[model samples]
Target: MEKDSGKHPLFFVTERLEFPPVEYTNEEGLLAVGGDLSPERLLLAYQSGIFPWFNEDSLILWWSPDPRMVLFPNKIKISKSMRKVLDSGQFRLTKNTRFDDVIDLCAQSPRKDQHGTWITQSMKKAYKRLHEIGMAKSYEVWEGSELVGGLYGIDLGHVFCGESMFSKVSNASKFAFIKLAQDLEKKNYKLIDCQVYTPHLESLGAEEMPRENFIKILNEKN
Candidate 1:
């Protein structure tokens, strides 16, 4: 929590692999920088209510934003149209079957206003490692022989920290999300961290809570 001039000092993680206290983050939620995405470091980051989110050319930036966006498992909203889509059985939902493909597609999918993705090659490899150890999971949507949509994230006991999702067709990702949420609810998961605001997530019942409250849940549940 050391201060530099009038601002908090950003910690440069090394072989020891540590982060400063989350309270040391600036107003933008940047907690630290320059940490390698080793599995241990990544787990520590998530368990501490922080996540890495920098573009390929930027230094590794860890963030713990105030007003964190999250969705309770049981609170996921499925509109009537979505319910029909679910019942029609047009898409098949599976968990952890094609994580590598899922993440690769997410990286390739374009965002409306964003330029380039934060899911860099290194980040994908790190998450793939996490998946190998069973700490990370993916929910994939398939239409016959083709993979269409999916999402992936870290599963910390009762919380799922969602990272990214992509869809090749309309409602594909939403179907994947709703299925995952329904499944998590059955398993008694407490929350799914959406990390930030999006109208899409808001429509599906995500709400922003203070960072302190989010951390409390992380500590208490996971």
Candidate 2:
């Protein structure tokens, strides 16, 4: 979606190693394009409330959407059915245990809103590197020894920026999400960064905050 910089977005060169002010983004929240996904760049992006989202066929696209969707760690809603699923002992949860598996499953999982996957090969590699460095985390839902569901994201100390999640069984992902929120609440995280909206997340108590406020809060905390 490239056009003249004045009318569209900034051209992000890898050697320059910096991003344009997110305020320069066009209406779609695309701030810049064409950067490498080195761990340094990725970490900085998350810290600045920016994230890379592009397909293999496109240049690396960066975004910082306004009215960001976030979930307070203490405000996660657990439906009665979810509670029943939890109480049933149908699954067990673990953290940072299988990030590669989780991300792979998420990439393979179909989405109703789009065709193909945004979690490209480069994205997966970058995130796995982040996981190796303790900056990325995953939550695994296990039914017996089988991994049925999970989610992965970058953890910026006080806020966890969720990337993607997938479930092999009904409510497995939801169970993992609720458990994650409960645990993070106990650990004093400010919120979970959902980035964009999804009705599924909204149903679980995620809400929108202004972009300026979201960045301010992200900066103020971690």
Q: Rate the local accuracy (lDDT) of all candidates.
A: 0.91, 0.89
Count of clashes, each model? 0, 0
Clashing pairs in 2: none
What is candidate 2's lDDT per residue for 1-222, written digit by digit as tens? 233548665656465567777787778888888879999989989999899999989999899888799999888988898888989999999998788999999999999979999999999999999999999999999999999999999999999999999999899899889988998899898989999998999999999999898888789753
Candidate 1 per-residue C-alpha lDDT over 10-108 given as tens digits, one digit per residue, 9 for 90 to 100: 766666767788888888888777858989999999999999999998999889999899999899999999999999989998899999999999999
Error of 1 at 163 (Å): 0.4
Each candidate's TM vs. the true structure? 0.96, 0.95
Best-matching candidate per TM-score = 1
Which residue ranges in model 1 land beyond 4 Å of their true spot? 1-6
Q: Which pairs clash in model 1?
A: none
Least accurate 10 contiguous residues by lDDT in model 2:
1-10
